[model samples]
Target: MAKASRRKSQSFLHGALILTASVLIVKLIGALFKVPLTWVITEDGLGYFNTAYNFYGPIYSLATAGFPIAISRLVSESCTRGAYRDIRRIHRASAPIFIGTGTVGFALMVFGAAAYARIIGNESALPALYTLAPAILFSCLTAIYRGYYEGLRNMYPTAISEIIEALSKLTVGLSAACLILHRGMKEYEALGTVFGVAAASRDYARSAVLPYAAAGAILGVTVGSALSFLFLFCRHRLLGDGITEENLKNSPPPRSMRKTVSRLVRTAVPIGVGAMAVNVAAMVDTTFLQTRIHNVMEQNPQVLLSMYQGMIPQINIEAHTVPNFLFGCFSMALTLFMLVPAVTQAFGISALPNVTAAYTRGEKTHLKKSMEAVLRVTALFSIPAGMGLAVMAGPVARLVFGARPSLPITSHVLVIMGVGAIFASFSTPVNSMLQAVGRVDLPVKLLAVGLTIKVALNYFLVGIPQINVLGAGAGTLACYFFLTVAALTCLCRETGILPDFLSIFGKPLIASILCCAAAWSARGLLSHVLTENLSTLGGVGAAVLVYSLSLLCLRAICRDDILMLPNGQKIAKILEKHGWIR
Candidate 1:
């Protein structure tokens, strides 16, 4: 029993580590896709791509987000009670819901594409929206299995599917974008037109080709989602979730399908609403940021232009595409800012089942320990990463994206967004824990207030000539800061368990400060002797070394945290011999 308990506990961190490792690979592949695609289609084209995605976000959340989490939590609770038969029933009951919602989401994206594009004031985004619509259905299908396996504390299927999707995007999406651009340019050169549209000049022809190129790139995402769903479907059939006939015979009778579906809806609605609030905030950002920036451009073009002075492209200004162009630059910064949260999101997903199991069993001590470990791990990662990005925003941007003309704007936005990433990253795991402990509606309320704050701030700030695009970053920082603090407070109150705040947050804060200082000092020193990219790399290396050492010296991580890893017991013994951990 003790050995079985240990194995169960290990599954949480082991699963988190699996998903985290996969996230790193997927993000690396994403960089390969987005960075080169940015060059192929330019920042303006990326704006169209992201605009379509922004619209997709809320609808996708509405369709698929809550149910998987609902399923995961329900499955975890059922597993804790040894209801293997009910687990099978839960999977069976989820099918119709997923199929129904996915179909509706796909239809909405397709039929609403033109209207959404016009509302966002960028008609060029329509084709990308249409191409990306099918992903909604496929992603919903994929989510069903991901949530089910995650509830069982299995991360392999989700991780594998994500990698398959990312690889598809990198290979198929990038190739398609490049092919479209090349063919369009070649046609312009040969026949003085691009795709049957006569152009006044080569540049004009390229401009005309961008919307189609962005759509072609998005087509890869649609294809990848479909392929990922197929893989999940195949895997489920072959492996069969490890439930045995004996287990099923011993388990209690399964709930009625109607009862199970009702329970699922009761659990999913609040969670889905919270998820939708977050995505709607993204949609708000998309709508308000562009509209406000367009307002600034129309009312005070010279003031906004003068702020960036020679950085804003003449072609963009002349075509009145400065809004989309600036949005594209902001998106570039967002691409990097999101990586921190993406990594921590794995922690949230993995934590749900473990925390759920402990809480359901009324293991108060175990629950507290699990909560602290999740928080501590989240802090140890998010704090330093956010700080490092803030400290090295410029060099990192220049390194990843090359010295594009937009670096000035992109780097500036990244500085603010890097700070925001810390709060955003921490919020995910905190909310998951809250849901696990049965306060599922708190996240929705908190997110609603936070989204209001964000929208109001962006509406006012982005319209300011000087703050135009930077305002979006500022709004994000403000929104997440409030959400993180409030969510953590609510978690404590609901769980009636105040975790070791100092150990969870304080030590990591000190370590992260040192890490950022080391990065900054190292970068400043190395810049005098080395090239910019090399110096940035050196600074990052220094930060990692310092952060690792600081964690050991401060003992920010505990033995249980270490024990969560593969070979963790042996590693803990080594650290204990050296008195590096307690």
Candidate 2:
């Protein structure tokens, strides 16, 4: 029994690390894809792209968010009880739910693309919206397999499939966008028209081509989802989940499909609602940022324009595309902000099954240990990363985006968002733990209040000429901060387990502050001798070094945490030999 328990714990940690590594690779590929795509489509074009993307988020969440989690939790619980047949049943029951939801989501995005575009006041985003719609169906299709594998404590399939998706996006999406842009430019230069439409000016010609270019880029995302689904489908058929014939024979009879579906739906709805709330917040940001900025332009144009003097282009103003242009700049900062959460989100996904298994077995000690480890690891990564971004926002922004006119705004927004990213990153794992422990409804309730607060703050602040889009960042910070604290409190209350707050949050906080100070000083000192990009790299390197050392000195990571890694026993011996860890 002890050996089996030890193996399960190791599997959990290995699964998390596998997903984390994949996230890093995916984010790197994403940076390569998005940074250059930004240059190709420009910020104005990106606005159209992002506008469509924001609209897609909630629908995607609605279609697929809760079911995978539901499937995972059910499979984990059944696996814990040694009911292997139920695992297979859970997977079977999930298929129709995903297919139905995906179909509905795809149809909605296709038919309702125009209305969403009109409501957001960016009619140019329609093509991007339409092109991106097919992804919803495919992604929903892919989610079932991801959830099933994750539930079985296998991370490789999920990791490999994600890499396949990212690579496809990078190769297919970027190429298509560039091809469209190059062809459009060639046509304009030779014929004074873009794609047979008369262009009064070069600027107008480029503007006319941007929507299609954004759509072309979106085409890659759709293609990637389809390909990812194909990979998961083929892999599942070729390599059946490692359930043995003996295990299935020993298992108790599986529940009827009707009961299984009912149970899955009951588990899924609250979790789905919680997940949808997060995406709906993004949708809210998209709708309000554009409309409020548009209102500001209508009612107090000079006040807002004066705040961003020379940054808002004349062409954008003439085309009434100022909202999207500004949103695009915000989105640029958002690209970096999302990377931290994306990594932690993997932690959340990896935690759900392990935590569910522990809780299902009524293993109180193991549950608390799992909870603390998840929180500690999340803080250890998120705090330093978020603070580093805040401290080095300008250098990092300039490094990735070059000298675009929007850099100043993007940098400023990133500074605020960097701090917000910490709380945002924390919320994912916390919510996952909550769901794991059976208080799945708490996250939805907490998110509802938090998002209400965020929306109200955004509406009030974004309208202020001086605050403008920075208001959105402030709202994100407020929303996630509240969600993190409240959810943590709720998790403790529900579980009757008081996690060591200092170990989980304090030591990391101290280390992160020192890390940020090191980064700031390093960047300042290196600027004299190094190029901006190189200096930024130096600062980042210094920050990482300082943060790692600080954790060791403070013993922020416990021995058990170390032992969860591959060959952790040998690594722990080395650390203990040096008295670096207890």
Candidate 3:
């Protein structure tokens, strides 16, 4: 029994590390994809693309979010019990349900794309919306297969599919956008427009060109998702044929379709709602925040128009670009990259089996310990990463995106959003824990409370012209902070696991602050001796070194913490030999 438990723990760690590495690679490739995309499409074009995405976010979540998790949970539980036949039953039962929801989602996006775009205050986004509509169905199909593989304790397929999807998006999306822009440029030249001109003409040129380019860029989403579905479908057929054959030989008669769907809906609702909560908040921003800004501009157009005349270039650039691009960087760079892997990426998925096993066995002590350890591991990674990201936002953005006119605001928002990243990371593991423990519904309820607060904050803050983007970041911070606190409180109450807040969070916070200070000073000093980009890079290198050494000095994290990381054993042994583990 002891050996089995130890092996399971090792397997858990191994899977988590693999998933983490894959997710990090995917994010890096995604960032690489976005940088050149931003250059090709520009901020204005990105605005339309983002608008289409924001509108699509919730519906896509509805289609894909719950079913995968529900299926995974059902499948994993059966696998744990050696009920291979039940696993087949569950997958067979889920197929029709998945297809139905996915179809509905696809239809909504395709048929309602025009109305959705117009209602969101960007009729120009309709082309992008239409182009991206098929992604809903494609993504949904991929999710069901991915969930099945995940339940079987496999991560490679999902990881490989993600890489393929990113590659496809990068290759196809960029090519399409460039081609569209080239055509647009030809059209403008034929119409007697000069290449090198004043800001006014450039603004006009962009208005005519960017919409088509944005649509072309968004079409890549549909293409990539379709390819991902194909990859997963083939992989599933290849790997599961023998299992399917065996299951069919021993399988019971099919359950009633109504009963199967009822079970699926019951399982999917909470997981789906919880999973989609963040996207829902983003949709709220898209629906309300953008319209509010438009209203503010309209009410004071004369004043704004006069102000723009003196700063024509800056105004033109900002007028078209700032909102969408800024939000994308915040969502992708900080939210997806900096925060997600801590818990939601692979950690949560890996935890499902152990957590569910312990909970199902009614091993209260084991479950509590498992939950706390997960939380601690999450904090050990997320806290310093968040702080480092905040302080290094400017340099990081410049490195990734190059210096653009809107960069200062983008960097500022990134810093502010970094606070949200900490809380967001915290929320994911806790939510996952809750789901594993069968209190999945609570997270959705708690998220609702947070979303209400977020909406209120965004309404007031985003309306202020000076605090426009910053306000959105601030709202995100507050929303996630509320959810984190709420989730933690509920988790402890239910599990009788009061986490050592000071040990898990406080030490890391202190060390990270010190690291940030050092990083800040390094950036200032390096700037005097090198170009801004080079200086930022130097400062980042210093930050990493300082933070790692500081962790050892403060003992914020120890041998156990290091051992949780990939290549952890060798690294821990070296640290121990060096007297760094104490």
Candidate 4:
């Protein structure tokens, strides 16, 4: 019985890990496209984009009511009740409802574009405003479909479809952004006057040029949306076909659509609200960061328009979002969205009953052993990984973002975010543990408190003279670090084991110090050996190798620790069918 349970647990963990990896790949690819697309559109537009999206996002999230998760919960319930066909039926019914809601959301974005632009005090924003409208609707459809698929007794198709959608969206968005930028000054001026530029453009002694300029912006919008929809809809068709072909034909029908949706909506309301609340906390940062900046610069458009502006777009408002959105969002949020939380929750859910059963039978030792294993493993991964990110901060940014004209601000912001990145990674598993044990409110409350601190800090820090966003970055680090400590404290209190914090700190601290020194020293020699920025890959390569060797030499983590490391010996052993040790 114990062996069977252990196998089941391992299977769940393995599956979750695979799904997480796929999601991360998809997210990273999407980001690869989206970031450049954004950069192209916004020399100064990132701040503008941030203003609109910050307010628009909460509404967008609310419109979906987090339907995907709702669907998952419903599907799980229906499956247990032997109502598979009913699950499909519910989604079929809900599809149009989601679309209709999305239409309203789309309309709100489109019609409200001018108002939003005016609200942000930039007439130039009108074009981008209308352009993003289609995304809202497409995203809405994606959410509903994801929810339905997750609830349908499998998640691989959903995961694959997301990858498809992300790849397609990124390709389309980036191509359009690049084309618009490459066309040069004419397009740049045209973008500036997208909505109302015609009036200002009329002063252009050549009034005939107005029409062509206007057309470019309009064409950019139409094509981008058309491509996104094309990709998403195609993915949907392929997924639907795959489902029917794989096992649905042989499977029984799901249960009543109404009942399934109702139950789902009930659970999803809180979950959706939880998700929205978390986003709103971010919105608070977004709303305040720029305001603080504007207060200091006195809204100097010239200063705001500097080439360095790209370094601190509204996208970089929190000091953390840019770094996270660029890369870490996937590894931490997208991948762990399924892996750490889902797997941990599965473990907790499965174990809770076992613990209860064991305790009833007076098996204290079994309970202690079980609880200790969970805490220890969670600490082992979460602690070291967070430290690794914090340590590798500057070098990773250098390697990933490169030394652009804007590298100074971008790199600095990224390093500052490094601490928060670690906290985010560590806290995820802790929150998952909370969720695993059915303590949903705990995480919501935690996020709420963290957000409060974030807001207060961003408000105070974003305007600290030239410190500007650097202080905001500090605020971000503080929020997550505080949250991690709180979560760790709570975990210890709940489980009765104080993690060896001193030892946990030892590995990451040493590893990061070594990495920083290696990167710094490497920098001195690197400039002499190679042309500036030409040696990006080489510099980063040497630095990473040194960091790894230092860690091993210091015995920070055993050879057994690496499962996903490149050229991992243990992985080779398993793949080659050698007797393996974990």
Candidate 5:
């Protein structure tokens, strides 16, 4: 039994590691892809691009975000009982529901694109919204297969599909945006629409190109989702055959379709509502920020136009600039979104099997230990990752977005958002654990409370002339901080599974602080000898090395902690051979 338990634990860790690595790779590619994209589309175009996404965010969440976890949870529980037939029933019932939601979402976006743009105070974003509408449908369908695979503890399909999605988005999105920028610009110039014209006409042409670029970039989202859906569908077909064959041979009775659908919905809706709260917050940011800006400008075209006057021609500020600029400023917060999948994916994927299994067996002690291990792993990576991002925000932003005049502001935003990212990382797992234990509604309630705080803060802060975009970042930080605290508190009270603060967070905190100091010092020293970017690169490289070494030397990373990684055994062997560990 002990050996079996050890193997099960290792299997869980292995799955977490695979998903974590895959998510990290996907985020890196997505970030890199955004670099040339920002250059090609410029910040103004990015603003519109973000505006479209802001509108799409809630609808997409409504369509697909909650079902995966719910499906995974239900499927994991069924698998734990070895009720294989229920897995087939779950999928059969889930398909129509997911398909219906996706269809409704797609139709709503297509039909309401103009109104959404108007509501967001960015009429120019209409085309981009239209371009992104199809992605909702594709992504929803993809989530079904992903959820199924995850339930089966198979993460490779999701990983491969994600890579394929990212690559496709990068390739198609960049190519399309570049094509519009170069070729499309020449056409406008040829028609004397924007080029070699008076300032007014030139301004008109500049504004005209932004929507096209935004739409082109958004097209990648649609294409990428479709490709991902295709890949997942094929993989699921090939890999799911064994399970299907077994179900056929066993000929186990299936549940009623109505009951299956009802159960899945009952489980999924709360998760969906909670997940949608994040999207709702994002939508609120977009709408409130733009409308408030428009109101502040008093809806006067000239006043709006003058805001962009005296802009550095090389830096590309425009009349309709603030909304896009504000969007671009806050868009850097997406980097925080990237760091989340590392902690969240690991915990979220494993939560179903580990947390659910323990809960089902009424093994509170096992559950406590499991929760502690997961929390330790979460802090092991998330704290350092968040702190590292904050410490190196400038170089990271410049390296990713290029050294533009706005890099400083964007980097500053990243720092603030990086802190929020840590909170979000914690919040995700807590919420997942909550759902895993069948308390799905609590997250939705907590998220609602957080959203209220976020919206209030954003309204008050974002409207300030001086605070503007930076205020949005502050509000976001506060929002997730609230949710994280609330969820962590709730998780402990409900499950009595309090993790060791010292081991889980204290050591990581100390080590990360040391790592940050080392990295900061290295950056300062290298700045004198190298260019800013190169110095930053060197500093960050130093930080990673320093953090790893410090963790080992401080004994913050124990043998068990090392062993939980996918390559933990090999890593432990090497460490022992070098006298790094005994």
Candidate 6:
């Protein structure tokens, strides 16, 4: 029994590693595309993109209704039951629900874009708002398709689709902005006009020079992406004929449509609520803090909101969302992407089946042992990744925000947020483990409590004068810390598979400490070279290299750890060939 639990841990790790590699590509594409988009739209226009996105994101989540989460659980359970055919049917049945709901969600986003801009971003923002409204359709469809494929234990399609989505969005969004630039409008002004809507106190004079070039680039991309997803749906019709024939021959006496719908609704609602509760911080933080941070920078209070809305999320997405998309779609939704496949792919191919056998037998000792292996494996990856972000927070913030974009408030917030990320990262695997074990409701309660604390803390922190945005970051850290402890405890209590407490807590702090030292040292080393054109690039390279080496040398992560990933063999082959290993 214990070994089976270990197998799940290994499986989760394998998923996470594959996801990391795939996610890296997705993040790169997202960053590359958004950079030009940001240049075109201007910081203020970026605000509009954020506003439209915020308005639709929650809806998108609601439409998804935890489809990926529910699908994965269902599929895994079926696999456990050896009902392979049913797992396929479950995936097929779920997609239309997502599509139908997603279509309505997209329409709502389009209709509400202007209103959202005025209410959330600024009255002067209309261009960015409208331009990004269509993004919702593309984004939602992309997610649904990926989720469907992931439920089937396929990762490549999801990975490819994410990269394609980023490529499409970038190609379309930027090409449209570039046409404005071709007209001789400066980059900032052209982009502002493109993504920023016409609002009160609008600066029309700045945009007057550029001819209106709608439907050619950005809009076309949006339309094309929607069409592409429709094309994928077309293949389903072709595939459906075969699927229906197979199902008629093999399916358990045709369940009533009402029963299927009711089953999906019942399972998905809880997952959706839990998913939403965890992410509530993203939607609420800006709205609550925007009014208060106004005093600190009355002339441009939107700075903090912009950072949270446009900047921080955009940066974090490279690490989280794009990876999430890649993992969810191709790797095995978020849970498998983040945990199972990566670990299995890394540690040992035989590890998972052995663990699974142990779990099947319900050997409590083996489960503990398997969890121990998982704890060790998770750290080998997380310690380095989390530390890299924490230590290099300043450089990362500088690179992401651009050299001059890091104000005292912004600078401090980025570093502090990295502090929060360390805790949040660990909590993720723990939460996923609970979901995998079919204890979904437990995570929901934990997340609800943490979110409530975060919200309450944000209000109190925002009231303080000097703390300002730092308070928001602090609140986030508090939330994650609370969740990590609570979730870890709950999982241990329920399963009796107590993970290595030291690996969980001690490693993150050590990684953070190493990160801080390496980052500060790199900053000192790069201080002379960092200025004007070279600052962001120079600082980032130095910090990344330094932090990475420090972690390896300190044994925080090394050859053995690398061998634990799905990609471990390749890594091991390279290292051993190079004599980095015996």
lDDT of 6 by residue, 432-540 (tens): 6566555668878988899999998878876565555567677777988899789878878878676667654465456546655655666666667666335445544
Q: TM-score per candidate, in order? A: 0.98, 0.98, 0.89, 0.67, 0.91, 0.73
Q: Give candidate 2's root-mean-square deviation (CA, Å).
A: 2.8
Candidate lDDT values, in order: 0.90, 0.90, 0.72, 0.51, 0.76, 0.53
2 against 3, candidate with superior lDDT: 2
Residues 46-163, candidate 2, lDDT per residue (tens digit)?
Answer: 8888888888989999998599888888888888898888988999888888999999999988998998888878999988999999999999999999988888888888999999
Against the true structure, candidate 1 has what lDDT? 0.90
Candidate with best lDDT: 1
Winner on TM-score (3 vs 5): 5
lDDT of each residue in 378-437, candidate 5, tens digit only: 887788778888778877777677767666667767888878778878877778788888
- How far residue 365's Cα lies from its native spot in candidate 4, in Å, is 12
For model 3, how big is the CA root-mean-square deviation?
4.7
Report lDDT (Cα) of residue 229, candidate 5. 95
Residue by residue across 415-508, what tens digits does model 1's lDDT show? 9999999999988899999999988999999999999999999999998998898989999999999999999999888888999897788998
Q: Against the correct fold, how does model 5 do in TM-score?
A: 0.91
Instruction: Give me candidate 1's TM-score against the actual structure.
Output: 0.98
Question: In model 1, where is the ten-residue run with the lowest total lDDT?
Answer: 1-10
Clashing pairs in 3: none
- The local lDDT score (0 to 100) that residue 496 gets in candidate 5 is 74
